[model samples]
Target: MTNTFSPLATYDRDAVRHWTYGTASTQVPIPPPTGSPYLSDLSFVSGANGWGPVERDSSNGEQAAGDGQPITIRGTAYTKGLGVHAAADVAFYLGGNCTRLTATVGIDDEVAPYGSVTFALVADGRTLTTTPVLTGDSTAVPLDVDVSGVQDLHLVVQDGGDGNAHDHADWADARLTCAQ
Candidate 1:
């Protein structure tokens, strides 16, 4: 579908914000002019990850972007999804044309038995759904959030209380159902 998004006052496509934990900073890329049901097909408006850059269809690895393995949570592998580190917020402009957002979120198996994180789905500025603290050993949390009339959607992953050491998170098979 065509992207009908016009930049809101809060969203600056060229702005960059630095993180407190480390030297890593958020890089805001220009949002795609077109939209797709699959989130991986659309570019993020703004976001940052603790480790490497946010990867598409793969898990966050120790090296560079797109160097991650298949997105796996609790032994289940996903072919399509987003791989991000904790303290990450990936946003997409919906233009109030989307109906729903669905995904199975969890810590990637790459850091199994280790990392901890929390997943939250935000529509516009309000939180729609949030998962409990999820560890590498925890099962994937399924999310189906109503996003109708929402202009922006954010997939946020935060470090669970402790520090963000091994917090590799995944949004498996993430898909958005939008109006045609």
Candidate 2:
């Protein structure tokens, strides 16, 4: 006599699993900025928040979503940007309407002397630009990438081989130059 078990019997259909990498888990529709091409104003196709929800035009804080302070990096305050934590990904669908993307990337000062992370810009599944390992002591790095004819854009932040502790990251003054 032999006994066999079906894989379907062990599967939990109602269980919800959370993903921290690869694809995003949240999606939101953003209103366009008036007379400006800031990425913060564009709708995000998908997003994954590492710790707290990504903050718009503010620094990643320990508080609830949208409850962050002004985006600050190296003591410099920015009026426009996206505040996210490490192991985060924010994707936007450009539909080939954008030409260039620019931003000042850095580890938010809120976690100074604590967190470390790396920032990357991926266009249509290809890495257009990436930054070196950035720490709280590092100054903000400027990024300028050409996204000509690209349909998808992903702004990613990864923990620098270290645990995601206080890994607050910021994309300051992020903007996209696109056709009107």
For every model shown, the clashing-pair count is 0, 0
Report the C-alpha lDDT of model 1 over 1-180, residue by residue, as the tens digit. 233333323333458643333233344444432333678878787778888899999999975977999999999999999999998999888877778788999999999999999999888799998899999889898988888888888899999999999999999999988766
Candidate 2: lDDT over CA atoms?
Answer: 0.84
Model 2, 1-180: lDDT tens digits are 123433322333459554332332343434332234777777677888898888889988975988788999988999999999989999987777778888999988888978999999998899988899999999999998898888888999999988899899999999988777
Stretches > 4 Å off in candidate 2: 1-36
Residue 7 error for model 2, in Å? 34
**TM accuracy, model 2:** 0.80
Assess every candidate by TM-score.
0.80, 0.80
Which window of 10 residues has the lowest lDDT sum in candidate 2? 1-10
Residue 62 of model 2 has an lDDT of: 74
